[model samples]
Target: MLLVTGITGHTGKYFLKELINNKYQGVIRCVVRETSDTSLLDNSGLNIEKVVGNLNDKSFVEQIMPGVEAIMHIYNIHHSPVIVETAIKNKVKRAILVHTTGIYSNFKYASQEYKNVEQKVFELTKQKECPTKVTILRPTMIYGDICDSNMSKFIKMVDKLRVIPVINKGESLLQPVNARDLGKAFFNVLLSPTETSGKVYDLSGEKPIKMIEVFRIISKEFNRQTTFVSVPLSLGELLAKSIKIITLGRINYVEKVQRMGEDRSYSHINARNDFGYNPMSLEEGIRIEVKEYLEAKDIR
Candidate 1:
């Protein structure tokens, strides 16, 4: 049996689709929160067991680990230590952890926690007696649909507003992997356990593109001419701080503006060679996102 978490989330949904499409002949168990909508799983027509509980609860995770031979942990990297410890105790064979490339961020405040959790995971799996073989797949910014938080926001903003604000003249490079591509990567890695276990793969996009070009792509998809206003780093930070204060800490973009100046690009050559991982180009991916956004909002 294969245990999957976050199966209802944006990427997880796609992963589940891949499993169904590929005819994975295994009993699948999914861990979900009490409030998570399981309509998709209910209609998926697969023999799946839905266990509702918090992954942070060790006892809850332990109870579900009895028959689960493999695990696809797709949510909350912070909860990985618990999952790893439990998987080890349960003697699970293989575990695929979905982590983020944000661990490489230059911003210490954001990257420190990821580093700490990853360090713990590394230490846990290094023990000689550890039974579970772990594979960590770190994806760059994930974007493909309206459910995503990254490009969807940009798509909505670009569609609604004619003038877009850009930090550092929007020259910083970003390589965002599509959610479906990441989902396929998970499925491929799961099948090729021999090559993926005890390995780390960076699932990046086909190539890097400038941040300004990202906005421009959405504009072109909508067939609209958009104006980009260059906002200096210092000024952007100041405005973000002011917004946070005025909103009583409800709105905060101070760190986002700061990080916008840093280039975030990673190579996935190793992933391609090992698991046949291939990601779509940004132009094509953004067009899909725009179509989804338009359909969701019923906009022409």
Candidate 2:
């Protein structure tokens, strides 16, 4: 069985689809929390085995680890320690861990929660030869047809604000990989665990573009005359820190925005050489996101 954690997330749903569509030739088990949204899995005609429990639960994870051939651990929650322990204890053959560039970008600025979870992964992986091989995929900003990404968020904000905000004259660079490409990267990791083991693959788009240029794409796509208001990174950081405390449980949108407004691009040569992973260009990904956004708004 292929156990996929974070099965209800943005990329998780598509990960399930690729596994099913490619006829992975095994049972696809999804580890989900109590409040996880699994509606997308309904009527997908998949050989799915749903395992409902906190992946952070040592006992619960142990129960699911045994007899599983491979594990696609795609969560950033508090599940790393338990997952690593259970995988080793059960001698699970492979563990394809889906991490993000957040591990790098947010290394200094990341919330304690993200840091703890990330540090735990490295610590556990350092223990005992690790019965399972670990493939870590650090994906860049991801956008897709169903995405409400930074671009889409701005488009939505345009509905409210006559101006769009940019940090440091919108000079920060971003390279967004499409959801399908990200899903394919996950699938590719599974097929070539040895090549990817103990390696961090930074999956990115073909090119990195500036933030202001990105906003231009949004404006052109939505046909909005949204003005650009640039601010310094220091001010943005101050706002992010303040907002981080104010909105406790939310996704920390400010910190997330600040992270995006920072440049962190890398070579995909490793992904391509290791598993033939080729992502869509930023232009194409943007077009797809725009097309989907328009369709959803019924505006075109």
Candidate 3:
């Protein structure tokens, strides 16, 4: 039996599809919110049981741990410690937490939260008392499909705007792993639990490109000869701060603006060496995403 959290999320859906496509016949259970759309899972014809609840409910989390061999936690990192702890109490043998490579990027609140959750997972492996084995998979900017927030936003904006904004030449490097590739990585790690146990690997795209190149790729995908406007990083940061204030901290564009000027590139050597995690290039990923976007909107 296997338990998957955030089963309706981007990577979660792909992970489920990978499991079914591989003829996995094990019992699968998903923990999701009451409002999450389950059409993705419903259309797949996979035998999966859905438990409607929030992850923060400790008792509810414990109730679903019995007879579960492994857990693929692909949701909020903040609840990882509680989930792992509960998994331990129920004697779940294997666990995989889908974290982010942003922890290795420019240090910020989000990175700190990821780091804290990772530490909690690691501490479990060292607890000579518990028999549960944990693996952490950190993926760089996950992009692919229209559901992705990374390049999809750029593609939408470039389709509507005359001029696309680029921060400080947008030279900062980015290596975005396709969500499907990340899903495969998760499956691979589950296949070799012992070999990947107590280890953390960075899952990234095959190639890294400049930020400006990302904007150009989106423009090219939309067939738009849009002008790229290079704005000063300082000015962009100021605007982001101003927006944050206007939105009453509802939107933190400051972090997004700051990250634009910092390299988010990461090495996938460990992931490749460990689980043969070879991801598609940014261009190919973007092409597939554009096709999906166009199809979804009935534009192409």
Q: What is the TM-score of each candidate against the true structure?
A: 0.97, 0.86, 0.94
Q: Residues 1-300, candidate 2: write the lDDT tens digits.
A: 888887778778778778768877778888877687777675667777888887545778778876788888877645666776688788888777776676667534654665676678778778867776666777777777655455567556655677877888888788777777888889878888678887778898888888788778767766778788888877877888777788884636566656656786777898899899888777777778777766877963
User: Taking the tens digit of each residue's C-alpha lDDT, what string does model 1 give over 160-269?
Assistant: 99999999889999999999999899999999998889999899999999999999989999999999999898899899899999999999888888889899999999
TM-score pick, better of 2 and 3: 3
RMSD of each: 1.3, 3.2, 1.8
lDDT (CA) for every model shown?
A: 0.91, 0.75, 0.85
Model 1 segments beyond 4 Å from truth? none
Give one digit per residue, the lDDT tens place, for model 3 in 97-146: 88888887563668887778788777876787887888888888888888
Q: Point out the higher-scoring one by lDDT: 2 or 3.
A: 3
Model 2: CA > 4 A from native: 33-40, 106-108, 111-119, 145-149, 237-261
How well does model 3 score by local distance difference test? 0.85
Q: Give the total clashing residue pairs for model 2.
A: 0
The number of the candidate with the highest lDDT is 1
Give candidate 3 regions above 4 Å deviation.
Answer: 43-45
- 10 residues in a row with least lDDT, candidate 1: 291-300
Residue pair clashes in candidate 3: none
